[model samples]
Target: MTNPAIEAFVQEANDILETLEDQLLELEGSSDPAQVDAVFRALHTIKGSGSMFGFTRLSQFTHHFETAFDLIREGKLAIDGKLIDLSLKARDTMRRFVDLGGDNAEADQLSEAAEVKNLVAALQSLTNVTSAPETTEEGASQAGAASEIAVFDIWFKPAADDLRNGLRPDLLLGELEDLGDVTHRLDLTAVPSLEKLEPLQCYAAWAVTLTGATTEEAIKDVFIFADDSELEITKHEPPVAASEPELTTKTVAADKGKSNKTTAPIRVDSGRLDEVMDRLGELVIAQARLNQVTTRLADPMLEAVTEDIERLLTGLRDTTLSIRMMPIETVFGKFRRVVRDLSAELNKDIKLVTKGGETEIDKNVIDKLSEPLVHMIRNAIDHGVETREGRIEANKPEHGTVILSANQEGGEVLISLEDDGRGLNTEAIRARAIERGLLDANATPTEQELHQFIFAPGFSTAKELTSISGRGVGMDAVKTTVDSLRGNFKVHSQPGQGTKVTLHLPVSLAIIDGMLVRLGSDVFVIPLSAVQECVELDTLETNRESGRSMLRIRETLVPFLDLVDVFNYPESKDTRRRVVIVRAGNAPLGLIVDDILGQNQTVIKALSVYHRDVEGFAGATILGDGTVALIIDTAIMIRRALQQAKAQEAPSKYVAAGGH
Candidate 1:
């Protein structure tokens, strides 16, 4: 079994490393003191925690990286592009050590690897480069940082119960000694008789005399994270006269975490949270069942009790969901490195601008969101953005811009990756589609229809392939992931303007507010996020002769599909029918159903493998009466309409998503 401390350290270390990369990137532009301090604190915390948790190799590697920041803190060195590059590379090395579960032979081998040796040598050289002539006042301070001149006395004793909490006094002392010259003696006076002693308890203390160019606060920082420990430091003044008694400065350590009035976050494994969410979903279903029973009983007291349970369930559900809601910025932060590295590799002046990062979404959705976004970003950089000279010739800025923005709608989150570059060449795309036999030669499709072919399998407009993209798999993968999430993807581009790809996704996949509708005796669900409104099907406006149909509501025409025909269910015999207006690919899609049942909270369940490939349905859910109702996939319905049009070579003003 892994020690809880080690587990916590690993989680915290990964989080720090993620933030550290962004911080390093920020230094390239700002390099402000506050940012520098943040980077330093992150490294210090990781080094201290790694050592405490037996990640000795990781701690050792981070110490060299930390030393560079220490120079920056003291104004000895400066933050430059070269130093940031080294820091980033060294940061990767530290992450590798952490991932190795350090202190093992593999980590030891990595510690002596060629790459590790070179990185350390480079950092040491950077430190040496800061050492100017000792004649200059600034250089003198840097030169004597490690030289023995100033003197200090230090004492430390661990809290009796701290060893059980993964305290390592020896490692702490070793880290301090690295700062300067030291002579130390161990004190075992606290040890009791052999019969009375507790083996698990720590009964050791240390007293040390140090001579170095270090300050009292610097020495005190060695025990920074060892809260509630007996630590004292006294700095001895240099002798002014031969007979004068030496005066010293005495200071005691204070608790660090409590100095800030914020409580430390408790890290629970994601799996545990998922389990809790699963249980909560079941409770919601049971509550629905209870509500149904009370309505059937028509008892005042039972209905009142059911109301209380319903109110309580609502609060619990909201609280549970809020815990799972993480900011999209966590993922957004990773893309800075992506943009930076890509800029270097492509030799293009490109900028990434992000907005609305504070928008929140489900962790599961965010987890699957990164890969597709990366593919799109890569596509935008490689294929969407033009070269600097080409952009200049086009009367555009020399540098290209990719704007990644996210915002939450009523029940959906809209994430868009838009680029101000040479927009999609619709004519070229149309030509390729015709050549590939993907479109009817005589049929004229809209610009949006031509753009859809950009995401088709094995589709590429590049004359020659590069390592970045052009295999045509990038956009195809994006579409696949989006479809699986039951999300909508729409592309809007102007010939000279740019292309913006917007993904409309639900805020949560586990549970959603769904509109219940019926087709004959069978019931189905349409995600409320997709539904715009419902209106009466005023007329039987069928166009089978042209293999197309439309529904006119007020003054607008929408492509409409009958659920009965789509699902092969019995047609409704009612005198009136209704159409649910759903947003699809910049236009409204209408779904004709027998009748509308009221909306309800839907707990989504993945379909069994045997039924997973069934079209027109996203997932299955248990209705209030305990029967399974398949959720209608609005995105799929739109795509199905698109495909049906192509099969018939129908000419229309709009096209749906599956293939454009």
Candidate 2:
């Protein structure tokens, strides 16, 4: 089995690398001292932890990388484009080494790779060239002088669960020993009796006295990753006078005030969170069944008890979901590196501006959104944004801009990518659709309809293929992913202005507020957020003589769909039916059902692969009565209804032209 300590090191190293990239990119804009220190500290922690966990190759490589940042920290080296570029490249190389699990033959080969050699050479050259003769002499003079050797009284107590989490206190103490002369003592007063002792729990503490020429910063670096540990350090100065021979001691409590005043949030494994959510879903289903039982019994006390349980369950469900919600900014931070690299490759000046990043969504949704968002940003930079010369010719700013923004709209989150570049070419797209046989040559499609052709598989307007996007697959993949998330996207563009694609998705996929409806003996659910109103279906107005499926609601022409016909279910025998009017985009769609079964809080379960391809159904859920009901994808149904109306109208239009 793989060592858990090594695994933890690898995971932490990956996290540090990600943070380093963000800091490095920020350094490019402004070289803030705090950011520089953060970069150095991250590298130091990686190197220190890598050494303890058998990542020798990674440790050594980061040692050199850390040295370069150390110079920046000490004001010996200046932050420049060349240094930042080298740092970013070196960061990527370090990531590869970390991936190799340290000290492997492949890592050795990578260490000797040409790119690695060049980066090291470049870094060494910077330090050599920037080191002035006087500065070197001054550093030599300081080293030659008798450095003050101070004694530090150190105490460390690891948390009970620290060892189980893969913390190696011995390795940590060894690291401290390398810093200076040390005498150590172990305190086992907290250890439990043999019968009660837990092998994995850490109950021992340590006290040590270290005499060293090292600074306090160097000593603290040893425990940088052990934030949960209780640690204290006291500095004891050497005797002020030989005659008196008395040392002065000053005690410094490590984060004592902060620890006492604040509570730190615990880091939880996502898998555990998922398990809790699954159990909560089962409880919700059971509670719903209890409600059904109580209502049937019609006992006052039982009904009151069931009502209280329902309210408690509702609150519990909301709290569980909130635990899985994370702000979108976590995904936004990585895009800066993308835009920077793309701009360099394409030789175009572009900027990415993001807003509403604090808006939160389900973690699962955010995880799946990264790739689609990357593809969209790449498309915007490669195709949407005009080149520098082209922008100048159009009297626009030389630097094009892409704006990524998100916000919450009721039960859904709306994420939009807008680019100020050459927008969709409607005429060109229309012609391309005809050439690709996606549309009739004589067909005249509206701008919105024509714009959709960009999402068609293998559709492209580019004359030649490039590394970026000529082989048109990006937007189509975006659509597929959004659909899988039960979300819908809209494309709006104006030639010479810009293009904006907005995605509307539910806040969570686990549960939703649904309006249950009956179709024959089967039941279906419509997301309550999409429902506008319910009205009685008029059979006379919907008869064959009218040749129309439109319902006029308060001066608006709203199209309606029979759920039975849409799902191809058997007809119902019920004489009365209701129409649930829902707003889809700017249009209102009426869904005709046999009866309205009232509102329900549904725990959504995704459809199996076999039924996933079936349109007009988002997923399935179990009702309070233990019956299965399919959740309606109202957006898809509305689109289908409109398409059917268009198909029927086309034949009539052709006949009218023939008569004319």
Candidate 2 lDDT (Cα, whole model)? Answer: 0.82
Best by TM-score: 1
Native RMSD of candidate 1 (Å)? 3.8
| Cα lDDT of model 1 by residue, 304-374, tens digit | 99999999999999999989999999888989888878877888889999999999999999999999999
Encode model 2's per-residue lDDT on 1-660: one tens digit a residue.
887667777878998899999999999989797999899999989988787777778888887888888777655678888888999998999899999987989989998989888888887887775453334565555543325687888888887788887777888888888778999999999998999999988999999889887666777888887767887787666754556543333323345536554665555788898888888888888999998899899999999999899899889998999999999998998898899899989999998899999999998899889889998999899989999999999999999999999999999999999999999888888778777766666665567767777777777899889988888888778877887787877788988999999988889988889999998788899999889999887642553323557877676677788888877788877888899998755557889899998999888888898998888888898888899999998878877775666556543321110000
Per-model TM values vs. the true structure: 0.89, 0.88
Q: Candidate 1's C-alpha lDDT?
A: 0.83
Superposed model 2: Cα runs more than 4 Å off: 129-165, 168-213, 236-263, 539-548, 570-573, 651-660
TM-score of 1: 0.89
